[model samples]
Structures are given as C-alpha cells and as structure tokens.
Target: MRFATYEHRDQHHVAVVDEDGTLRPLSGVHSLTGLLTEAGSVPELLDAATRMLDAQPGPHVSEVRLLPPLQPPTVRDFVTFEEHVEGVRRSVDGAAGVPERWYAAPTFYFTNPYAMHGPHDDIPMPPGSSVLDFELEVAAVVGRAGRDLTPRQARDHIVGYTVFNDWTARDLQSAEMRVGLGPCKGKDTATTLGPYLVTADELEKYRDKDGFLRLGLTASVNGEVVGEDLLSNMSWTFEEMVAYASRGTVVRPGDVLGSGTCGNGGCLAELWGVRGRQDPAPLKPGDTVTLSVEGIGSVSNTVVPGADPVPVPIARRRTRERP
Candidate 1:
C-alpha cells in the first residue's frame, strides 16, 4: 500500500492511498510517531492503514499537498556507488588528487534536516551557485533502533522507500574538499524527498528473479532527458550500507539512509565532462529538474537563484601527503 503525509485545510496528517485513488486519513488510526518509531511493525500498520483507507471517502488527488512521509530524526546519506565516486575522482585527479581509501570503504555524511523540502516545492538555488546539479537516489526509512547490526539483520529494519534528489553545488563542493574537510557548504543547500512512501511489501513484488531490486530511474532538465540508470547497478547493497551505518552507533526509527547518486545516473559529471572543453549546463534561474524512480513517483521543482548576492569565499587547500 502507498502512504503519504499530506496537508489539508491547515493541519498536517498522514493518509493512505486506496485502490480507488482516494486518500483516507490515518491520523485517526495511529499516531504518526507511533507508526514510524519501531521496526518490523510498519507492515502491520500499512495493512491496517489500507483497510482504513478502503472504508473512508476523501478528496481528489489534485486538492492535497504532499509532504515528506516521515520526519526522520536523523538524515544520513551514504556514498555506496562506485561510479559516482570514480566520476568525481577522475574529474579532479589532475589538480586536487584522489584518495585511495575512498574506493574501499563505504562513506556517508549527515545532512541538515531543516533544508529538506517536499515533492512539489520550489528549490531556491543558493546565493552563489553557478554549477547546481542533481543526484537521483533511493532512500530507506529505518524502522528499528539498533547498533552494530549485521547485514542479515539490516533488511528487517527498513520501513519503506522514497525518491530523493540530492541537489548539489559543484563549485562549492570542489573547493571545500580541497581542505580535507567533508562536504559542508557544497551539499548543505537543499534535499528534496517524496510524493509518497511505498511500503517494503509493495516493493517486494518488483524484485527480479535474480534477487535484485529492479527500478528504473530517470532525470530531466527543462523537459530534456539528461541521465538514466537502473537501481540494480549499485555496487554496495542497501543491507550492506545499513550494516556499516549501524556500527558502534545507534540508528533509530525514522532515520533515513540514502543510496547515494546512481552511476552515470543523474549528476553533471556523469552526463557531461566534469572539467573540459564542454562545460556542464549548470541549472539556470528558470530550469526545472524532474527525477522519477519506478514504483515510487516523480518529483519536479523549478530552480531560482537566491535574490541577494553573496561573495564566493576563497578555499584554502591542505598540503598533507596522500596515504
């Protein structure tokens, strides 16, 4: 069953999408936090939610504002895709150099939750961004709290799936990484999630005979298709990412784990050269980017540069020897 957090009138509430395409309020059935605060219970809740949706009558789809399904306590994104890492590494090899360990370990970063937006909202391009790009990703909502979880135990902790667009500022990212610091300013601008959350059981039917999740992902800029990739190409599985993330730390319910950018999937480096004669067509003031992942829905937003002008800070590089 499909579920969503929606705003009707003036209040925000949870709803379940029914077979007849009607939305039924789940707020009366269960508390939003109670539905998402534990593991292995989402399936039962979804079943109950579906039954509740089948019984109630509600407004048409065009009248509701869809919000991000879960208010995750912590938003963690992982770089488990080798293709994206390699693409960035190759682009900066001549000037900035690449790290050896980056290819071996699964790396991740914590993003600011305050910057997240829903599916149909307008994404404001940061004050000094001339090279804005998009990352198409599939994110998992954690349902259980745990530490040091094994790969076998990781799958059980997932509640559902949602499409994510990790909007990025390429110029800022490059400059910031030169200091050996993580992607702070480069990636902190905005992250878009939503349309709806599909429960794990609803997605299970789409799993291929080969035991891999089969989902088609596509990205478009101003009605032009720019990148396309499959979810099956991921080098590190979601279970592995979850296992790694849970090591020595507590991962709570409603926490999100992003599957990084899909290979040659959605970023500018994957679509065009990172640095070359042909510069990527960075998003302009009026460009609209739409990301669609099969099973889950599509999210489209228009880009507008920030109104006020701000100075671009000069970056200081670290001279430490490479390991």
Candidate 2:
C-alpha cells in the first residue's frame, strides 16, 4: 500500500492511497513518524488505517499539499555501487579504482536528517558553490528496530521505499574528500525525498527470480534526460547496507538508509566517465530535476537562486611531504 503525509483542514495528516488514487486518512495520526513508531506490520497498519478511513471523508491527492513522508530520525547514506565509487575516485583524484577496504564491507556516512524537502519543493541552489549536481538513488525506511543484524535478519526490517535525490555541491565535495573527510558542506544543502512511500509488498512483482528488486532508475533535468541506470546494478544491496549500519549499533524504526549513487547515473560520473570530464553544465537556477524509480513514484524539484553565497574553503596542498 502507498502512504503519504498531506495537508488537510489546516493540519497535516498521514493517509493511505487508494487504488484509484484517493486518500484514506488515519483520523488521529498526524505524521509518518506516528505511524512508523508503532512498529506494526503492513497489513496490521492497513487494517487500522481502514478503520480510520471510515470515520472521515477522503480527499484527492491533488487537493492537498504533500510533505516528506517522514523527517528521518537519522540518515545513513551508503556508497555501495562499485562503479560509482571508482568513477568518483577517478574524477576527484585520478585514482583508477576503488579501495580494497571498500569491498570488505558496505560502508556509509551520516548526513543531515533535517535537510529534507518534499517531492515538488523548490530548493535554493546551495550557496558558495557554483558546481551543483544530482545523485539518483533509492532510500529504504527502516520499520523494525534491531542491533547487529545480518543481511538475512535485516530484510524484514525495511518497511518501504522511496525515490531519493542526493542533491550535491560537486565543487565542495571534490575539495573536501581529498582531506580524508567529507561530502559534508558539499552535500549539506538539500536532499529531496518522496512523491509517496510504497510499502515492500507493493513492489513484489518487480522482484527478480533471485528475490532482488530490479527497479529501473532514471533522472532528467529540465525535461532532458541526463542519466539512466538500474537498481539491479547496485553491488551492495540495501539489505547489506542496512545490516552493516547496525553493526553493534541500534537502528530504529524511523532511520533512513540510501543506496548511494548509481553507476554513471550522477552528474559527477557522467561528466567524468561519459562526458570526458568536460563541463556537462551543472544544475543552475530555474532547472528542474526529476527522478523516478519503477516501483516507488517520482519526485521533482526546481533550483532557484540563493540569498547568500557560501564560500568553499579549499585546503592548500602541502608541498613535498609534511608531518
């Protein structure tokens, strides 16, 4: 079943989407957090939602304002696609390949949980950097809490999926990562999520014979197609990333984990690997970026001018070698 948080009667409400595209709102639940906090299975949540539905008249999705499904309790974005990692290393430092340790385990970094936007919001082009880009990816929302989970055990913890746009400031990222840290100021700007949240069972048909979700991932800018890839190409599945994230630490119901960027499916990789490192012309004011994943719906955002410019602090290279 699909779910959304929409505005109605001057208040936000959590609702389930009907087959014909109307909403069946839960009477008392006001946010996605309230719904996920219960840790109930999909069917149980649906049953309860159905009861609430009968108490209120439904509204069409077009009549309401949708918000990010949930303000993530925490967010961990994983760099799991080998080709994406290799391409980035090549672009940023002219490295030919991924590190050996990268293959040893699924690795991830924590990003701003509060830097979120809805499907159709217009985000200000992050200040400071002129080089801006988009990363098309899938985000899995954790439903059940666990610690030290294995891939086998983590599978059931994922409750739903959504389209994720890891909007980036490429110039800042390139400089920061060289100091052995960051994607921070580069990525801290904005991350767009949602058109709607699709529960795991809703995507069962997209599952391959091997039980992997083989959704097609694509992104376009200003109605022009830029990158296209498949979720099937990810080397580290979302489950592996989820489990790895739980290594000795607890993962709660509202946490979010991203599948990183797809192969040649981000502007950085596309510019370097496919476009010969030429300027593909990063996103600018008035440009629209739309991202779609097969099972989950699509999310689109527009870039506009920022009020202030953010300065990039590029660290100077040390001459020869300094201790």
Candidate 3:
C-alpha cells in the first residue's frame, strides 16, 4: 500500500493511495505517525483503508496537495556507495578511494528534518550558493524501533522506502568542510521527499537473491536527463546503515535514513569528477529537477529564490595592543 500526507479542505490528512492512484483517508487516523507508533496497527489501518477503497475513490491524487509522507523524528543520510565516496574524495582529499574506516562500517551524518519539502514543491536556491546541486538517492523508513540490532535483525525494522533528493549547496559545503564541520548551510536549506511512500510488501518482487532490492535511478533537470544509476550498486546495505544508527541509541518509527548518492552521476559533484563541470550547468531559479526510482514514485521540484537574501558575512578589524 502507498501512503501519503495530503492537504484538502485547508487541512492536512493522512491517506492511503490505492493501486489505481486514487486516495482515500484512513478513517480515524490523523497521521501516519500515529499508525506507526505501535505494532499491529498496519493491518487495522489497511482494513480501514480497504473499506474506503471499496467505496468510490474520494479524491484523485492530482487534486490534493501532497506533503512529505512523514515528519521524520531524525534524518541520517549515509554514504554507502563506494563510487560516490570515491568521487567526492577525489575533489576534497585529492584521492579517489574510499577510506578504510568506511569499509569497516557505514558512516552517516544527521541532517535537518524540519526543512524537508514534498513532491512538486518549489525549492529555493540557498542564498550563499551559486553551485546548488541535487543528490539522487533512495531512503528507508524505520517501521519499528530497536537498538544494537544485528544486520539480519535490523532488516525487520524497515517498513518502506522512498525516493530522496538531497538538495545541496556545494559552495557552502566545500567551505565548511575546510573547518572540519557542517553540511549545515549546504544541505539544511531543503530536501525533497515523496510522491508517496511505498510499503515493503509492495516491493518484495524487486528484491534480489541477496535480499537487496534492485531498482533503477533516473534524474533530469529542465527536461534534460542528468544522472542515472541503480540502487543495487551500494556496497553497504540499508540493514547495516540502520544497525549502525542504532549502535548506541534507539531507532524510532519515522526516522528516515538515506542510501546517499548512487554510483551513477548522482550529483553535480560526482558528474564533475567524471565529465568535468563545463556543460551541465549548476542549478538556478526556475530550473526543474525530477528524480525517480523504478518501483518508488518520482518527485520533482522547481528552483526558486531564497526566502531572504543570504546573510552578510561579519567583518573583522585588528586591534592594537590593549586599547
């Protein structure tokens, strides 16, 4: 079953999207958050959902305003693709290889969850960024909560997946890394999520012999295809990423964890490594970006001006002795 939070009648509602692309509200349920908090609720939620579907569809998907499927309690994006890691390292470390530590275990960073946008939303180019880019990736949503779980055990915790576009401000990211911190201003500006969230059961057919789902990745800007990849190329698995996240802390429902950039030219940074940064220009206002995965739906966003102009940098002056 596909799920989403959409706006109708000036209020947001949690809805189940049927196979026919019709949406019907889950009776008595206010948000996906509530259904996810406890076990055995999905079946009940489905029964209620089915009842609504049994009747005529309440709304066609196009009529309602779609919102991010869930308000994630936390968002951790992991760099698990060796190709992406190697590409980024070449630009920053002057080496094109994954760090030994990364092979030992998956590593990730926490990003702002509140600033995320939904499908078809307008994303502002960060005020300080002239090199805005998009990271094409996929994300797994935590269905159940646990800590210190093994890879096999962690697998059960994931309930579903979604296409994730980690919008970036490359200029700000490059500068902050020099000081050994951030991705703050670089990424927190916005993240594009949804079309809708697909449940794990719906994706069982896509799983390979090794239990990883095989899916194609595609992204285009202003109707031009920019990047492409497959989800199966990651060296690390979502179970591993989830287990690593739960090593010392609890993983909760609604916590979103991403697969980072795919091996294909998933972003301008990686593309620059392969093709150089000459022809495929950086994003600007009015440019539209659409990202999609095989089974999961596609999400598109248009670039727009920042909410406010970039804040000016503070000026400094030297003082003489002890004035």
lDDT over C-alpha atoms for residue 208 of model 1: 70
> Which runs in model 3 stand beyond 4 Å of their true positions?
40-56, 92-94, 309-323
- Residues 86-135, candidate 3, lDDT per residue (tens digit)? 77666544566677888887888999999889998899988768888899
The list of candidate 2 runs beyond 4 A from truth reads: 309-323
Model 3: what TM-score? 0.91
What pairs collide in candidate 1? none
How does each model score on TM-score? 0.87, 0.91, 0.91
Better of 2 and 3 by lDDT: 3
lDDT of 1 by residue, 47-86 (tens): 5565555355666546888777767778888876667776
Better of 1 and 3 by TM-score: 3
Q: What is model 2's C-alpha RMSD?
A: 3.6
Ranking by lDDT: 3, 2, 1
Ranking by TM-score: 3, 2, 1
Task: Give candidate 2's TM-score.
Answer: 0.91
List of clashing residue pairs for candidate 2? 127-310, 128-310
Question: Highest lDDT among the candidates is held by which one?
Answer: 3
Q: What is the lDDT of residue 48 in candidate 1?
A: 59
Clashes of 2: 2
